[model samples]
Target chain A: MTDLRKSDRLIKLGLLMIAFSAISALFVITLFIFEQGGPIMFKYGLKSFIFGQDWYPSEKIFGLWPMIVGSLMVTLGALIIGVPLGLATAIFLAEFSSRRLARILKPVIELLAGIPSVVYGFLGLMFLIPFIRENLGGPGLSVLAASIILGIMILPTVISISLDSIRAVPDCYREGSIALGATRWQTVRMVVLPAARSGILAAIILGMGRAIGETMAVIMVAGNAAEIPSSILQPVRTLTSNIALEMGYAAGEHRQALFATGVILFVIIMVLNTIANLTASRQGKR
Target chain B: MKETAIEVRNLNHFYNRHQSLKNINLEVYRHEILAIIGPAKSGKSTFLTCLNRMSDLIPGARVEGQILIDGQDIYRPEVDVVALRRKFGMVFATPIPLPMSIYENVVYGVRLAGKNNRPELDRLVEDSLEKAGLWNEVKDRLRISALKLSGGQQQRLCLARILALKPEYILLDEPTSGLDPISTMKIEDSLRRLKQNYTIILVTNNTKQAARVADRTAFFLMGELVEVAETEIIFTRPTDKRTEAYLEGKFG
Candidate 1:
């Protein structure tokens, strides 16, 4: 018994160390980004660094307002396109589909997440761009292209998590509603959706995080024009695209500015993640 | 002669190939409490669900029976199941309160039926809660989450939800099994009063509960109803030996 206990303690300690390593790595990376990014912000003045609408690294002018606006517009556009489609698909799978159909379709929907992000970007470049240029009168590579690609990319995250939360609702809630003469659609709209609201919100928040953090795909399709786009047809550069496009040639304060972009992205993701956690925890308590 | 609220003839139920109920024949009178007492796997709950066609929700669950509600054949292929369900509101053993405020929980059924008038909704909520004996406790806290209520209060809230529908028949499946004694007594008291307005079908594992609130009692075993008689007669001088043995705690 003592030998078993001793081995258990050793295993516990090893697992604890592994867990702490992941957390410590996060702390170190965040500290390093802030340490590298903080001086540049102070030198340029925080307001000017964030709000100035110009970007000329060679001229030592780094205003990230355009990129920030670009990121917000792209993320917002993705959500507008993704949320309704994802939620509807999730509802169909969780509530309406027969078991055999759900079995086949759910896995196929989840498989979308496994396909590489670059492949989606490539597909957008190949087909969506030309189609948009011909039909919508745009330069092919624009905020519209980026939004469509990111929306497709985030569908798996939204659909799977929303489906899971919808399924997690107890059958009794449905039974009670049905027993009271509610149709299937009525029951889902009233009881099941309300019961799963927090979880669905959390799923959407996580999907938002995914859309904003996506780099390779957005960089490929967003056209990387370092100016604030006035319309969906115009080209724009997100904070992520700004970093990925310029990091290879960047040195000195320009490199620090890239790290500063990382800092902003990290903070946004952390806030979204925190909100998701709160929603999930509240659901658990209920 | 008492009016028949519901009549079942040669009722048979199956889940895939396995039969859950066999040749169930019974009649529930209007404004009467009929207690169904049975051990586990006795098809009591299945019998109740079949009345409202709640079994339709379960995959591979099939029913072959003549269930007449108000002289209409409920099992007919063209019957609107939603309307049939509204006629017989059900309450399960476990209390399932919707994730909403107490007032909202009671009006959920009414709202689904597309009655959205505010004054009518307020009246219905108050009337239903009063009938369920839950009004005094929750009247002042109508906006609070129903989940914040005690287990017993939650169960009453479920009862209020059904009451808001104004169902002709109320089907209860071991509603008091999870409740404490005081809560059970409160439910029993409300059930006795409710029989004045609606017919009730109660399935219970506790014989004492059956004796307390039942006007008539039916005994079932292994998907078969052994005997059904007046509540007092069934308890004291049962006709069937199986019923006698079950009452004496000989075997389930």
Candidate 2:
């Protein structure tokens, strides 16, 4: 009995050590980014660093307004393309479709997430870019292409999480609504959707995070023009692309500016995650 | 001398291959509280769901008998199922508050029926809550979450939600099973008053609850209804041995 208890204690300590290591890694990365990036923001003034549109690192002019706009534009475009399609698919899979049909379609939809980001970029490069250039009158690689690619990339996250939350609604609510003469659509609209609203909102925030943070696909499809695009058809550079594209050649304060870009990205994601947690916990308490 | 409000003839219900109700024949008079008492899984709840056609929501659930409400067969195809469901209000064994404010919970059904006028809704909310014996307790904070209320209050909120629909029949399936005695008594008082305006079909696990509020009582055993008669007769001189055994604590 003593031996068993000692082994159990050792196992618990090992698991705690492993968990602490993972958390400490996060803390270390956060500290390192802030350490490398903080001095630039302090020296340059937060307003100029954040709202400056010109981003020539060699001349020591580092305004990130274009990248910030680019990130917001692409993420918003992705949401426009994704949310309706994802929510409709989730509702169909969770509430409307036959069990056998949902069974057949669910894995295929999930398989979308398993596809490497490069493949999606490749597909966008091959088909979507050419189609956009031919029809919408821009260079093949533009914000539209990246937006479409990122939109498709985030569908699995949105659909699966929304589906889970919608399914989590108690059947009793549906029964009560139906008993009150609510049509299936009414029941879904009034009760199930409201009950699942926080979760769906959290899913949307998560998908937004995924879209904003995606680098490879955006780098591949986005033309990487550092200037703010006047139109949706024009090329733009997102923060992730700016970091990944210039980190190789950047030196001195230029490199520190890239780290600062990462710090901004980190803060944006942290804010989004915090909001998602708040929405989810509020619903849980309800 | 009494009008038949609902008639069941040779009713048989099945979930997949499992038979739940076997040849149930009964007549419910208008403006009467009819209590159905049975042990667990004795088809009591199944009978109540069938009345409101809530059984239709369950996959693989089949009904092979005719239920005529107001002399119209309800099982026929091309029936307006949504309209049919609105004819009866149902309260389940557990209280479900729809995760909204108490005012919204009461007004949910009326809003679904497209009655959204504000003053009209307010009146409906107050009237239904009054009828359910919950207005005085909940009137001060109609905007509070129904979940914040006690279990008993939530059950009464469920009743108020039903009453807001203005349904012709109230079908309760062990609604007070989880409530304390005082809450149960409040509901019983509401039922006694409600019977004047609505036909109430109560399926209960508590025989004493039926004895307290039911005008007529039906005893069911297995899937079969053993006896149905006036409440005093069923309680004082039960004709069926199973009902006597059940009531005497011989067995469930």
Candidate 3:
């Protein structure tokens, strides 16, 4: 018995050491990013660095306003395209579809998340961008193209999580409503949706994080022009695209500005992730 | 002779080729509390769900039966299922309160029918809760979450919810099984008062409960009803040996 207890303690210590690696790595990365990027914000004045318009790296002038706006616009557009589509598909799978049909469709939708982001970017560039250029009349690569690709990319995350949450609602609630003369649609609208509200909101929030944090696909489709876009059809540069495009030979303050952009991206993703967690926790309270 | 409110003829229910209810023929009278007593897997609950067509929601659930409510066959495709469902208010073995305020839980069915009048909704909520014997306890905290209520209170709230629907028949499938004795007595009191307005069918495992409250008693064994008679006759001089054995605690 003593030997078994000793082995258990050793195993616990071993697992604890392994778990600390990820946390420590995250701590180191956050520290390094702040150390490299934090000085530039203070040196250039935080206000101008965040709100300035000019992006001449050689001149040491870095205004991130356009990229911030670009990220927000693209993220908002992606939500507009993704939310209703993903939620509708989730509802259909969880409540309406037969088991065989849901089984086939669920795996296929989840498979969308596995395809490389680069492949999605290439598809958008090859088809969606060209279509927009010819018909909608703008540079093929624009915020609209990026938003559409990102929306499709995040569907699996949104759909699967939303589906799980909807299914999590107790069958008894559905029974109660249906027994009260509620149509299937009415039961879904009034009872199931309300019961699953927090979880659905969390799923959407996580999807939002995915849309905003997406770097490679946005770089490929959003024609990287570092200027505040007048309209969605116009080319715009996101914070992520700004860093990836200019980081190759960027020396001195240019590299620091890129790191600063990463810090902002990290902060935004952290906030969204925290909000998603809080919403999911609320779901457990019931 | 009592008027029959519901008639079941040649009733057979199946779940994926496994018959759950077999050749059920029963008549439920107007304004009477009919208790169905049986052991587990005896089709008591299935019979209640079948009456309201709630069994139809289950996949691979097939029914070869004629259930007539008010002399009209409820199985016809054109017979609006929503309206048919509203005609039989059902309470399950476990109380299920929709995740909402107590007042909202009561009026959920009413709201679905597009009745949004605030004062009328308030009145309906009060009347339903009063009828369910839950008004005094919950009247002060109508806006609180129904989930916060005790199990017994929640069950009564479920009863109030169905009361608000103004259903013709009250179908209870072991409603007080999860509740305490006091709650069970209170629910029985509500039922006695409610029988003046609505027909009720109760499925229970407790034989004494049936003896105490049911005007008529039925014994179902292995998907088939062995006998149904007046509560006194069924308990004291049961014609079926199975019913006698079940009532005597010899075999369940």
Candidate 4:
């Protein structure tokens, strides 16, 4: 009995230690970001710093609207390009393609996802940016470049998630529809897509979060312009790029302003993540 | 001779390298309920799916058979499989309604066949629901999700969905296996009424159910047909000793 009690206590201690490490990791990360950027933000007033658009270190006029708008525009552009393509690929992979074709295609999609974002940025800078500059008459490093690169970067996430959701729908639903004399495409359009709608929506939201929070790839391609871009061809600066670019050199009010931008970007991502979580939970219940 | 609703000639099927159905031959008359009775893995479901070409959905499944519906060879390359399936529908042992409203589920078949007018759709939905013996229970909640219905109601909704297509032959593979006694009785009653307008081919493990609703019964064992006779004869005075042994509950 004493030996059993000692073993039980050891198991409990191990579990507690695991749980503490997980929570401590999360807490430490959050606290470090706050500790580094918090005091300056409080001193400079978050609202003025965030809403203000001008960022001139010499003149001391700093606002983050251009950065926020740039992030929103680039994310929107990525979504516009990625979501439909991802959904189409997912539908083909899950519903239309033969098992042999699906087998061949699935790993290719996974490989696309596995490639590092920096490599994608490099490829975009080397081939896509120059091609667009020659063909579309745009700056080599433009919002369009960032958007297209990020869109390709997030495609695998959307396709894989949407495919899993579509596949999760029981074969019975497909058989039921087919047995009713509905064509395969008709069944997919009318029954399968509707059943997987929430999951597909969650995929899109996750893709959006990935696009919004991406820093390294966007910084390499986006022109780092402080002004809000009026066209995809023009240079722009996103919230993430702004933080990464200025965190090293910024001090006092300028550093606080960049942190304020981070806070705003963090809020947008939180909302998106919340929506994805809620949708997945609701789909689970169904 | 009376018109045959379905004809199977020298039917054989394979699942990958394994043979599933062997040299099956059968005929189903119009407006009659034909029951296929067998123990598990007897290829009864395979035979039923062959009628509507559903067995082809599985990978590595191949069929060497000729299935004729109303004198038309269904396996001919010129024949439209989708249209053929619409004319000959099926229901599984477990009820599976599309994830849609009750009204939508009922008219799904009709809509797929391109009948889109609102008034016509509403009429079909009402008529099909009534025919499936579910209109009274679900009339007030036609817009409610079909998943919200009980298992029995979902089964009936699936029935209504198939009925709305106006198929000449309806195939049911153990349609009441998952229902309670009352629900099973309700389904049996519904099938009896439905036989007036549609021919039904049902596969069941229950001897009593075969005796209850079948006009004729076909007994199968180990992927081979053992006996086919009128329901009364098969239950009370089976010609084959295997059939007799099976009816007597001696090793199905």
TM-scores of the models, in the order given = 0.95, 0.95, 0.97, 0.95
Predicted model with the maximum TM-score: 3
Q: Candidate 3 chain A vs. true chain A: TM-score?
A: 0.96
**Stretches of candidate 1 above 4 Å error?**
A1-12, A274-286
Score chain A of each prediction against the true chain A by TM-score and list the results: 0.95, 0.95, 0.96, 0.90
Evaluate residue A273 in candidate 1 and report its C-alpha lDDT on the 0 to 100 scale: 80
- Write the residue-wise lDDT of candidate 1 on A129-151 in tens digits: 89989999879889999999999
Instruction: List the candidate 4 regions with Cα displacement exceeding 4 Å.
Output: A32-47, A276-286
- Candidate number of the best lDDT: 2
**Which residues of candidate 2, in runs, are more than 4 Å off?**
A1-9, A43-45, A279-286
Residue lDDT tens for model 4, B144-173 = 889999999999899989989988888999
A34-69, model 2: which lDDT tens digit per residue? 999999998999999999989999899999999989
Docking outcome class, model 4: medium
Tens digit of per-residue lDDT, candidate 1, span B1-252: 999988899999999999999998999899999999988899999999889888888999999979998888998989998988887879999999988889989998898888999999999999999999999998999998898999899999999999999999999999999999999999999999999999999999999999999999999998888889899999999989989998889877
Q: Which stretches of candidate 3 lie over 4 Å from their true place?
A: A275-286
Model 1 lDDT at residue B221: 91
The 10-residue segment of model 2 chain B with minimum total lDDT is B243-252
| CAPRI verdict (incorrect, acceptable, medium, high) for model 2 | medium
lDDT of 4 by residue, A1-286 (tens): 9999999999999999999999999888767666766776667577766777687755767777788889999999999889989999999999888889999999899899888888987898899889989999879789889989989988999999999999999999999999998888999999999889888988898899899989988988998999987788999999999899988998876776666676677777878788778877776565
Q: What C-alpha lDDT, on a 0 to 100 scale, does residue A18 get in candidate 4?
A: 100
